[model samples]
Target: MFKSGLAALIIVLLANAEAQFGVGPPFGVGPQFGVGPPFGSRPPAGFGLPSLHGDGFPGPHPRPHPFPNPRPLPPPRPLRPPRPLPPQPPQFSSLRLCTTTQLEQDKCLYALDIAGNNSIDLKLECVQTDSFDDCLQAVQTKEADLVVADEHEYLKARSADLVPLLYAHETLTSYYIAVAPKNITLLELSNATLDVNAMDERAFHAAALFNLHRGHDLCDQAAEGDVTIQIIDSADYDPTDDELLICADGSVLYAGDYDYSECNIDAGLELGIFAPRPYDTNRSFTRLLQNVFDTLINSLGQESEVWNFFSDFQGTSDVIFKNDTSGFSLIPVNRNGVTEQKFTSLHCDQVSLDH
Candidate 1:
């Protein structure tokens, strides 16, 4: 009777404990009735509410590392308008031309006057030198902006740093002519005496013609059966004194500008103009002068006042600014031609033998 009473009392105590803690193995085995993650235990992998750990599925949850939010970028500064550039300085207006000879000086002045009239912006000045050499020197030293020279002068000035800009066509024409005995054969003229008007003007062309005909050197001492070349003024030459006479067409033309058609002989070389190097860069100045020349040329056939200022004497005026030349043309300094080369060769150091 005493053992049965003790067992009943123990059973009643166990039942009351079950009612207090609910059904489960003691305090931490299996899931509790309605509680999550029973006590300190974890759910099975991938088999519970998401806990921000273990593949984001319900399972063991790890403490998440703290991360600060990134600071936003500063707003871009506003763009400013660009500053304006300064204006350029003004261009040169005055032009100085260096020339030789009274005719050329007068022509240059007259051309400048016409150009100045056409354009108020230009101011042309003239500096007259006694000779082509002086003109070239003035240009080289920058004492003068330009100098009008011939092919020979141009060639010489090239070594001195002179520049050839534009050709003053219909301005000046130099004709070299050879007047040999009409009936004498080249071989028979071996003993002939040749007279030249001016050594500087006619020597090369005359010698070239002589060489082309007789295949002899005009500069070397006359050999047996060779022609003797002599320099003399054309005005004093007599037909009986020399077998050959080399002269310029302008020399034959009368002072009043009349052509001596009877004196036409074998035609010769012609030389044009060579300007200073700076003229190549002075586009405005050259263009103005060129326009003035063009106007004068066009007015040649018409009854225009432009013709009155141009004193062309039988079209042989030595004035370059007037419309007297065949036409204007430009040749680069690098241009090479047989005729130009031949003419240039005659001026070589060997030319001293002619003296």
Candidate 2:
């Protein structure tokens, strides 16, 4: 009875232990605890703890670690250099021109306006004075750079140590024609009375030519002339059959049957822009003036619609330029082909009589 009771007690204790654990092989019988495989035998599925290899399956699901390995970063890019600055414009000199009259001052201002509108690189300033002589003095003292003057004034400018830099080619026909009877000749009029209506530059030029022909300086003074000369201001004088008219030649004049070309004088005269004698040696300023002249000539047609350079203002016959001026010429009076032939006969000091 005692042995039976003890056996039943032992069986009850074994059942309780099995329930707490699992019905698998003994702990160290088939595969050692936590070992990879059996010694020389293939291991069963899920025989050990969960692994990092191949899906980590047949065991408990894998729990990710608290921290993971980070990926490598790429290399940084190099920095670029800064940009450069832009260039600047050059400096230029200013040109000053002298004006005697109010009309001339206005014309110079108008020219400045035109140059500004066209973007021309001209820095022109107008210096106004009381008289034309004052203008010449201003140019001499460096108060002004240039002045516009006529042929008569050009001679005066030369006496003041100024030189002609540019000249206007007069559009009008400039000839001093001597008209007389058809039978009259130039040499036969040496002692005969010749009529000049005005004591002007034309008369002086005619007297110069007559004195050259008469082989004597008989008509140096404009009003004082030889017996061959006569002023037509007298009312007693009438148009005689042999009366000679020394007048300006033009298409309107009717010199019928008279060979006027036989005793004609080419008044190679025009307005000139005079500057100080030192300007003739300034190459840069000369180039600048030439460039300005070229720009003016090229823009004439366009500028005429806005402002005419050759047009008169305020009842004036000629303003800045002569009304009859066609264009500007760089060639000097003595070197110019158009005037060289006629200037040879004038007996001027500057002119070469040869060729």
Candidate 3:
């Protein structure tokens, strides 16, 4: 039957007309085939429809989608006006003070903190990533502001014309040598085996082989042609426990490893893998200045006293301060340009590869 017909029948039955309203009939039996529920009579059972429950009455009534949520809502209480959220710390327009390692990144941050925002609203971070060939890639990709590495590596980079923003002496202790026989020296040997390990395997090998070759050469130079030395293998040899330390009994000369420096007195071997030989000559420092010196020079023009906290460039009495007279030109100006300003820690290091 039509849907409208079914609805009409239901309405008529609900009206409770004993004499029949409009459809001429005795018991008011208007046919509403396939309509809604039966009003006067019970509906037929067992239509064989799927039921949710085993008892078969449309299974469990689908729990209300929201379960009706009939519970009374708690009354609202007077809210203490939210303490005005602490004023957001003034955000510096991000500046990229690139360096290597999150630790080095801390240098930029700490230095800025010392600079104290003096209108230099550039945030800085250090990056630990791929090689300079990759442009310290993380920074090249703008993951960091500036980047840093060994002055030697930096030299290689600079030679490529990619100069850093700053340069200053940094105390380091990274160069080290690992060997089983603790006191073996290249001068004391005809030939010996070696091993190398580092984050950059190729760079490590280059450094390793360079030092080894220089090791043999430098010994003869320092010894005035008295020492004769050669590596155990002409082909690169990996260090091993069984590796031999062929030496000339007592002619221990510096091969530039752990505990051995220009003096080459004798610091003992860094047995086993490179782990124990943490010769940090160029690694750890109170402060290391490295980067494009021009960048720091550029910061001098900003009106902010913040640059006062960075390392001083060129000379002690002079600094790179921003020129406000021309409206913020970052150039290295003498301290005479700044007024009512005090300089804080300004560590500097000189880069050298004259050797």
TM-score for candidate 3, residues paired by index: 0.25
Flag the better candidate by TM-score, 1 or 2.
2
Local accuracy by lDDT, each model? 0.51, 0.59, 0.34
Best by TM-score: 2
Q: Candidate 3 residues 1-355, lDDT tens each? A: 6999999997776565532322223344434654534544333334233334556454445565665667888999988887777544222234344443344445545556654545443344334443444444544454543444332354344444343333332122232322335344544332443333335433333223334333443222233333332322212334445333232222233232323222121111111000011111222210122222323435532333445333333333211211112221122222212111111101012233221
Clashing pairs in 2: none
TM-score of each: 0.51, 0.54, 0.25
**What is candidate 1's CA lDDT for residue 159?**
62
Task: Please give the ranking of all candidate structures by TM-score, highest first, separated by commas.
Answer: 2, 1, 3
Task: Give me the overall lDDT of model 1.
Answer: 0.51
Per-residue lDDT over 1-355 for candidate 2, one digit per residue giving the tens place of the 0 to 100 score: 9999998988786576455432434445544565444533434545432233556443455578666876668788777776666543322276788998888898778888887887765567889997889999998988988888765465568889998888776644344554445354545544545566444555445545544544554323333223444432222334455555553331212334333333354344667888888777677777766666565555542245655667676778677776766677877543222253343345454432221
Give the TM-score (vs. native) of candidate 2.
0.54
